[model samples]
Target chain A: MSKPTAGIFGLTGCAGDQLVILNCEDELLDLVNLLDLRDFLMATSANDTRCSLDVAFVEGAVMSRRDEETLERIRQRSRFLVAIGACAVWGGVAAQESNGNHAALLEDVYGPLGRQYDAIPARALHELVKVDLNITGCPIEKSQILAAIANLLQGDPPLLPQYAVCAECRMRENNCLLIEKGSVCCGPLTAAGCEARCPALRIPCIGCRGPADDVNTASAWAMFEEKGYTRADVDRKLRTFAPKGGRA
Target chain B: MSTTIRIDHLARVEGHGGVTVEMEGGAVRGVQFDVFEGARLLEGLVKGRSYEDISPVLSSICAICSVAHSLTSLKATENAFGVEVSPQTEALRDLLSLGESIESHALHLFFLAIPDYLNYPSAVALAADNLPAVQLGLRLKKLGNTIQETVGGRAVHPVNAVLGGFGRVPGFDQLAELRAALAGAAADCETMLEIVAGLPAASFFRAGIAFGALVSPREYGYYAGEEVTMALDGESETIPAPEYKRFTNERAVPHSHAKHSTYNGRPYMVGSLARLVVNRARLGERGLAAMKRLGLRFPPDNPTDNNKAQAVELVNDVDRALRIVESLLEHGLKDEPPVPVAPRAGAGTGITEAPRGILIHSYVYDEAGRLTAADVITPTAINAASIEDHLRRAAENAAPGEEAALTRAFEMIVRAYDPCISCSVHVVRRGHDG
Candidate 1:
């Protein structure tokens, strides 16, 4: 069988997700044999605009009207779609300014005339098109990418941990920063995967990886206020990558 | 009839830039470069915002060179308010900037430019045969990241850097680790130089093509300097940053949304090559020795040789970084609290040597110290025309008649200057006095 073709596209976010993939230093090249990177804008100008896509990975918050159209096009062409990182999965930091309720925010940003606003309110891939799988993190991890690719090659749905950062912290033998320093950490709320990077460094989790499924937002919010955090601070912290309905 | 090949979407340099190579009757006719970053209109966004609100917003103007944006913003703000950060603050900022230099330069060298030379699709493919070399690149790249993390507290959009100085300072042990690792990274620079020196470097791309960059009297301008030009034009000439617009001309090209630039209707280069050409005297002993030993011409014309020049600069930067750190510590360090002045209102400009090229940021402020206007002249935009000129010359030299090799030749020319597009987006700040 020929190699599976993958197309990576970035919408409107820091190109960090793609950078992370490019940063896979040692194993970076071996992918050519396993996957034909048919359309990555950052890598090369050579692209197959009409090729059949085996898998497509999309990064960044779907913010602009043009991006919504592009994401739908990608979804239509791709057999399987993966939302890489928190931006695509949960809208990410830039979305905070856009308001989680995409509809209301559309009115707020573009005004009530947003009703006539030609561009649809920027929404997650699932809102506009099918998202077969989602990879959650501030920036998607290499290991998860590898694992997902492996599963896809075998014709299986990709499996990734859906737990909170708390799970990873306890497993890493690191102390809980929230308890020790009285620092407000989102470890109990954020999706697990980054291995408690911020907490380990004595900084509280700012939730680069959006909220976990089982996250108790109200409880976490209360806990933060238990510390010295103001309401706005807690709001900003939880809202880094909040989904449309999650912030409220 | 002349055929014009316009590159509406020039690849991998940074942000959005385009190029045009006009071949009239198979002869070079006209070339224009432009920056097509569509009116992001960010200059208007920072207008009423406080000094504290400006950092992250400006930083996002370009993901690849956010450090430049942050530093330039800090500098212009500092200049406007007459603020002075501690020597410790200055040292850390330099270190972060140095880290960005390493990361940005390595990306441009390996991922972008080197691919054109080796005929590889990307750096990932090149890394296969050169795994160890890639690893060394990663380690060197990571050293900068470590610096950003230590000082800024986050690798991307560092929150710790602010108006007066840093929101927080690194502990002693963190500084020690960076100092030690940087000392160790010096070997990587030597190794990098050895590798580039050993690689098969193609001949000069264009002879007598002058380039310009910022250079200081006391030091090579990392943060500040006059715009110095080098070519047959002679040694360095100081054109103030505010005056860069005089030399810079932009036009809309059909090939790309990115605009093309020319200095007085002639293509010129910038970045490492420009810096190397302009600041060769500032290299002191080692830089001068490396230049002589590299056997590079007094002014190398071939665009491909810029990589070697960058490698040489890595040597210079590492050496300088070590020396600067040692001197700072030896002098018992100076810490002036970040001068805190509310925005009184004025227009100011700031320039810094972004890894790929010269980054100029200017803004006008209202009486409230809000940003009123902004203009950005990123290296990529400035060099786009020069890249086209080099490409036309390179393709003409490599294989003149064949449009088949045009893409390869074009990418090569673009990479030679190591353009960064995302850095080109701009707007002026409004001064309060206005």
Candidate 2:
């Protein structure tokens, strides 16, 4: 059996997801050996940019004409496309620009200059094209990505955690910040697989991994409001990584 | 006849960008270090965000330099709120930055820059014949990450070091383990230094190019700095950090989402090379020893010697980390919560030497504790103009009308700077065409 050919790409965000993959120090060598890698621009100078692939793992939101063209090219060439990290799975921090005047914003950053390139409000990968699978995190967890890749190679469906971060906190026997300290923790609404990292460390979860499958937006808002957080505060926390109507 | 040389998708660097050079009648007309990544409008987006959320979002600008971004943002925010952190907190923050420097420098030298010197397309290709070297690189990189994860809560964007102090400090045992790890890696560090120092020197040099870096009155450092020292042709001047705009006269260019920055009407250099050139005398005992061992002297003429500078920095950072860990262990770890904050309307600027170069994060906060304005000047944006200057020189020196040779030369020069296009494009203020 031949190895599965793959291409990993990044568009506009922090490039954190890809770095998380590189952060897999112990498994990187073996993982690369398991796949026919191509088009990882951050790690390789020689890329088969136009090569067809069994899977394409795309990170970052599409916020420019070039990103759209790149994502379209990869989508057209791959059998399956996986959206990696919050940027691709849900509009990441870049999507926070959707409510602002993009022209005015661009002017503030680069000044009133005639640009050869075009800038648009950031949109998730699914907003632009079909995403066969999605791995969510502000920067995707190394364990989740490694598992996703291994399962795909074994011809098995990748099993991602469907429960909220609250479940992980519960299993870890961590005290609930929301209930105990009146904190604005988003554990009940955020997806698991981070091992409740922020909450376990005594900091509130900011919902960076996007909402979980069983998230009850209205109920979570009500719960936080009852605990003294304002509706605006709750919305801001929830929408930082995954804004309303951002998910495809 | 006219011709243009293009390396459309520069790989192995942090973001999406390319280089283009145009020539008419065998003379260089124009050259651009274009940034093709979409503008995220982070400055505009960050407005109205709470002070606490600002650092976490800004840190996402570049994964490799997350520590620098977060720490600088915290500094700016703390200044806005008039917050003062404890000495322990300050030490931990410095340790985190050093960890990032070690991680980023090792990754760039071994995985990116070394491949260019060894005539390989990428590190993976190099790994085929040099597996042990690659393994050593990974070991060192993991050591850096271990420190980060132990202190910052996670490897990439830090969640613990907040506005005033850490939400949760590491335990005594954790610090001891990290101390032991740094001690164990000393021999590997020397071996890594030898591998980089022995590489064939990349032959590109132009005398009298300007260099800029943050300056400290204390020891050789990145975290403690309030002013910048500009080195120009054997003469140097110090400018306060708040007066950075005077030196960084940024300009908007049509070819790039990222703007170009010039100092005193000419392109200047930053990052490890610039840091060492300006602060060479402050290269503490360990840095001095490493420079001696590697036969490296101050003010290297070759831009590619940035790789060697990074090798020396790796040794310096590791030695610093060992001392930091020992100091923390001596004082003992505190599970102290973050200091309380009382916000007021104000503006502040935080400048530090990121792994690449100087990174400045300035912000204005409303009385309500939300952001009103924000500005970030990344090292790559400052180096963009300098990179283009080098590219133009490389093109001028190349055989006329040979596209391949010109393209390679241009790519090598750009790679030497290790520009992070993703971090560079998020500038907040408008720029003028210089």
Question: DockQ for each of the predicted structures, in order?
Answer: 0.17, 0.63
Give model 1's docking category: incorrect
What is candidate 2's lDDT per residue for B275-295, written digit by digit as tens? 888777877677888888877
Q: Give stretches of model 1 more than 4 Å off.
A: A1-5, A12-14, A24-41, A44-54, A61-73, A85-127, A133-248, B1-24, B29-40, B201-207, B224-232, B241-267, B325-341, B367-369, B392-400, B426-434
- For residues A111-148, write the lDDT of model 1, one tens digit per residue: 34333333333356666677888886656777888888
Instruction: List, in order, the clash count of every candidate structure.
Output: 42, 0
Residues forming the 10-long window of minimal summed lDDT in candidate 2 chain B = B425-434
lDDT string for model 1 (B1-434, tens) is: 66767666666655445666677665676554544332232444455555545655677556667777788878777766656676577776776777677666666666776666666766666666777776777676666667667776655555566677764466656667777877888678777767666766565355677787777556554665545453445644567766767556556445433355666567678788788887777875666666766778866667777887777776776677667666655665433435466786786677777777777777667778766665566776677667656766764564456765675566666667776554554211111111
Q: Rate residue B50 of model 2 by lDDT.
A: 84
- Candidate 1 clashes: the total is 42
